[model samples]
Target: MTANVLTIAGTDPSGGAGIQADIKAMSALGAYACSVVTAVVAQNTCGVRSFQALSPDFVADQIDAVLDDVRIDAVKIGMISNAGIAEAVADRLRHHGAGNIVLDPVMVAKSGHALLDPEAVSAVREALVPLARVITPNLPEAAVLLGREDDWTVQAMQAALPDLLALGSDYVLLKGGHLEGEHSTDLLTGPKGTRALKAPRIATTNDHGTGCTLSSAIAALLPHHDMPEAVARAKAYLHAALAESDALDVGQGHGPVHHFHALWGSGV
Candidate 1:
């Protein structure tokens, strides 16, 4: 049976992140991808110029349209730009009793453009975080959620995972890519314990949509009903996509990872 995955996020015209990347990642992982556009961003590989958020009612309508027909097994949420939209999405998910929600706390773009409003952070934490099966936050997003200024090392990242889990998420995956290191380390913590995922950092500026891709991949694998195993496999897939990014050229600025690297045999 085909796993059906849904992504609620903004539309990135560059196809590097947001709903575009989530859909690509889900499809590449052998899942049917469905989407709800929360915002429309005028962005490219370089940066985000401007964005217009969709109405909360419209966002809910889109989600409802999909869930009413499709047997959505998993959901990936990203780039909810405001508090109202976040609340609406949360309420709809609750009403539908959605399962296996993977949240990518996308605060800013790789080019340092703020993708989420500072005022909306609290709304996301209070309304949406609790509903998530796994909350995936990169270093900057984690720092923002925790309200810390200092850089997060691997030890600090591991230590903070529990506090994130305490926010009501069943699991937390703290991505260590933003931390300066030779190898990228992602820590997954849950009711059991911490699972450290290590992969050699590819020295390239082509990681445009990694967080979105990773979270969606996890969601795609979650319908199998194995959280830890899904996370492990998703991490491996993301690492390979990054490794195979050397040959492809999408933009003059930071490009996207090869989402189909596995099929091309360019990744391990």
Candidate 2:
């Protein structure tokens, strides 16, 4: 039987990010993808134009409709949008005793549009992040969570992992793509220890949905592998996607990483 993976996030009409990207990544990794949309986002590869959020009650209804029947093995969360949606998602996940939750704190879009509301950041940090087995935060998202906009060195990311773990997640994966370097590094920290994973930075502008892709890939692989292995494989999958990111020409702005890189003959 195929494992079920759920995404509680907004929708991207452009199919480059949010629920669209999450489902593509999950399905590519052999998981049944399910979704509860928090917002209907009007965006293309260029950038997000605007978004309309669903009612908190409706978001809960969508979550309930799925969790009540499906045996979701893992969940990848993104684009909480507001405090109400944040609290509602947390409530439902906790109610179901959901396992292998991968939280990607998607605060900003690749085009520099704000996906997370400024005020709701606190609600998500306090209410939702704790339930996640692992949290994947890019450098900017980590800075927003930590309230520090300082330059994030590889060492800074390593030190920040434990600090982020204090937010109640069992593990934290701080992605180091935004930092200038030869390799795109990620630090995974947990009770066991901290390990640094790196991949040569593929030069491409088509990285719009990298975070969503990575987190969903992790959730898709979690049922078959241990936590550290899942994260490592997900990072590799993302790196391959980035390597072939130029395959898709969707919009004028930052394009999307090819989620079907393997199927499309990436040979990675």
Candidate 3:
């Protein structure tokens, strides 16, 4: 049976991140995609200019409308612009008993723009993190969540696992993409133990929406695969997309990964 994956996030008019990237990744992975907009963001491959967050009640209404009708197999939550929206998303998902929740703590964008409010950090850590089956946070985000400095080495990342897991997620995917290495490694820790998942660091300027794509892809896959398997497959998918990202001419500063790289014919 096909899985229904819902993405609760903001917009990326450039179609490289947020709701646009989530839908593309889910569809590319053969899952039905659904979405609820939490913010309308003006951003492209380069960076975010400005954004307007939706009212918390309206965000909750959107969640209710979707959960009431569709059987959401999994949910990938991205940018909740403020504390109210963060609480609203958590409340609605818990109310619906949503499964396979993948939370990507998107604190700052790749271009150095802040996507989440400072006040929302606590709400996400308290309300949303506990509900996630897997929470994917980059080094900076992990540091913020733990109220400590960013991990600069693998050993430091390993040392932070217990605290990350204590944040309430069943599993924590601590991303090490910011580190200087030939292979991008991420530590996945849970009931079994910590395991490093590595992929060749494709040196390309097209890294937009990587977090959104990976988390959403996992959400799309979780209905059929176990946590470990789903994460491995999602990382592989993102790697391939990154490897082929240069094939397209999207923007000058940064470009989006080729989400349909495997499916689309040549010369797109």
Residues 129-211, candidate 1: write the lDDT tens digits: 99999999988888888888658778888778778888899999988887777888889899899888888888888888999
Q: Candidate 2 regions off by >4 Å?
A: 266-268
Reference-based lDDT, each prediction:
0.90, 0.90, 0.94
lDDT of 3 by residue, 1-268 (tens): 9999999999999999999999999999999999999999999888999999999999999999999999999999999999999999999998999989999999898988998999889999999999999999999999999999764798899999999999899999999999998989999999999889998888899999999999999999999999999999999999999988888899877899999999984467
Best-to-worst order by TM-score is 3, 2, 1
Model 3 is weakest, by summed lDDT over 10 consecutive residues, at 259-268
> Relative to the unseen true structure, what is the C-alpha lDDT of residue 143 in candidate 2, on a scale of 0 to 100?
90
Q: Candidate 3: lDDT over CA atoms?
A: 0.94
* lDDT tens readout by residue for model 2, 130-234: 999999998989998989876888878877877799999999999888899888889999889989898998888888888999999999999889999999999
- Best-fitting candidate, scored by TM-score: 3
TM-score of candidate 3 on Cα atoms, chains taken together: 0.98
